[model samples]
Each structure stands twice: as C-alpha cells, then as structure tokens.
Target: MNAKTTKTAENVTRCLKCRRVLRNASPDGYGPKCRKKVRAAARAEVVAQYKPHQVAKAQELLEQGGLIPLRANRVFLAVSSDGSATYKTHRAACTCPAGIKGLHPCKHRIAAHILLAA
Candidate 1:
C-alpha cells in the first residue's frame, strides 16, 4: 500500500476505549491498560457519586445479578438486601423504603445508576 493508505489503516486499528494507536491491537479493539482503565473509570464515577456503603451495596447488587432492566431499559428491578423483595427503580426514583423518603438516592437507585451509566 502507499504511505497514505498505510497511515489510514493504522488509524482504523486504534484502541477502542482510548482511540490511541495500538502497535499490537487485540481482537476486541482495546489495549490491556485501556481496557482496565475504562472499566475502572466507569466504576469510579459511580462510586464517587454515592456514600461508601451505598456503593458497596450497589456493587453487590450488580455482582449478584440483582438488577434487571425492564420497560425497554427505562426501569429496573432491584432485589432487596435480603432477597425477599424487589424494588422498581428508575434513574431518579425507586420504590424502596429509603427511596420513598426521598432523603437521598438509595442503594437500589445507586445500583440502577451504575447500570445505566456503564
């Protein structure tokens, strides 16, 4: 290929997450560091928006597969801490007791936010 064609092909093979040119690109399109950094950044942004306990619970909820999207992804079903109940959650509202009070975003809401943000 000519020099122009070679340079254009290089740009097309950049890291998916950071847009940096990759010398040895992976099939998934992300460099190792960029992959980790992208995930960490998404998680960090969610954690930074809430209290520690809430973030922890949100992480638990996500890891446990407790959050299920519904209504074309506009709402979610968040399983309670004890797994005995589920709260209907939206981006700004949740049916959980803490959410009903409206004092702050509850764990369920935080979990939903994390899902949507990611």
Candidate 2:
C-alpha cells in the first residue's frame, strides 16, 4: 500500500501531455517540450484557417511591429493599412471597418491570433 501511494504521487508529477516526469509541474500541466509543440500546432492551425494573403498580411504586420498587445495579452492595438490609425483587435473581433462589417477574422484579428499563438 505504501509503494502504491508513492507510485500515485509520482504519476501526479508527470506531464499531462507527454507523461514525462517534471521537477516542477507547470500550471497548465504540460512540460516545456509539449508546451512548445502545442504552441506550434496552434500557430499552424491559425495559419491554415486564414487565406494566404491574410496570413501574409499578418506576418508583415508582425515583422513591421504593427501589433501591440494590451490587457495582459487579451487585446491588441493594430496599425491601420493606411498607417494613419490604430484599431482595437482581439482574437474574435476587431474595431476596424472590415471587422465591423462582419468580415470575420480580419487582418488585425489574424495578427492578434498569431501573436497569441506565439
């Protein structure tokens, strides 16, 4: 019974994703390698869901430092295409005209999503 209790405690210290033993368990339960893989998968999924042009735009925005995260990374301030304005951007919504018109997943939102995936 004592040995079984020790085994159970050992299992509790293993990673949720890979079952690898960790010296310190993370709050999300994934080990470092698994967390990285998960993030990469999320990024790939977001890229696949968007059009090539939209993904390109989002990448360009990131390269040009056009998106600024806010509210503990929950929101973003994205630069306008005209370079004269900024919009409040979220993963599901954006304050840009295209987003307001119900063009879901606008460039700003895509950029924000990419940031989150990263």
Candidate 3:
C-alpha cells in the first residue's frame, strides 16, 4: 500500500472483485499490474510446499503399508499446501468434505499423505 512494492506494482491490477485496487485503483494500479506475478508467486509456494516426488513416494509407502486403496468410488484426491494427501472413509465423515464443499484444505488431505507414506 505504500510506494507500490515491486511485486504489487508488477503483478496485480485491481483486486479481481474489489475493483478498488479493482475497487478504486488507477487503471494501472498495483493489483492490475502485478496480478500475474502474484499468481506465479502463489503457485511457487504451493509447489514448494508439496513436492511431487516426495508425496508420490509417500503414496507408495502407504500402498506398501495398505492404509490407502488404489482406487475408491467415493474416495477423492486431497492434497495439502504442505504436500500432504487426504484420505477419508466417507464424505460426511471425511476431513476434506469429499470435494462437495469447502474447497479449503483439510485434515483429510493430511491423512492421504499419511496413507501414502504409510
């Protein structure tokens, strides 16, 4: 909000919804200009948090341990920001809502990681 951080100045335009930075920003405001860069930064964070090879190795461990099924009718894929997988028995009981609602990450995601690693 100060002198337009190089990041803010480069990637974001206005906030997608607010219109101020999407709401009350100049046509070339921070969010508008920096949105893509911001998105890339976020993506990098996600990737670093969840290393694919490590998580896959964890899944292999789970398979060896037999905590996770190879496939399930109700089973949903859940991955966490920290590279954890979600494993749940049921949607209602699932820590991740089985993907019907709450897109936010949940413990089910962690469970999957555990299962994979087991």
Q: Highest lDDT, which number? A: 2
Q: How big is the RMSD of model 3?
A: 16.1
lDDT of 3 at 61: 30
Candidate 2's residue-wise lDDT over 40-96, tens digit each? 744697689888888887867765657765677678888998799999999899989
lDDT by residue for model 3 (20-111), tens: 33444443222443434433433443334555664454334322332323354235344433446544433233444433465533344433
Q: What is the C-alpha lDDT profile of model 1 across 3-116, one tens digit per residue?
A: 755744334566533457788856545567755653564477566878887788776666566766676556888888898999999869999999999998998887667656
Model 3 spans > 4 angstroms off: 1-14, 17-30, 51-96, 99-118
lDDT order, best first, reads 2, 1, 3
RMSD of each: 9.3, 10.4, 16.1
lDDT of 2: 0.73
How well does model 3 score by local distance difference test? 0.38
Q: TM-score: which is higher, 2 or 3? A: 2
Give the alpha-carbon lDDT of every model. 0.71, 0.73, 0.38
Who is ahead in lDDT, 2 or 3? Answer: 2
Worst 10 residues of 3 by lDDT: 61-70
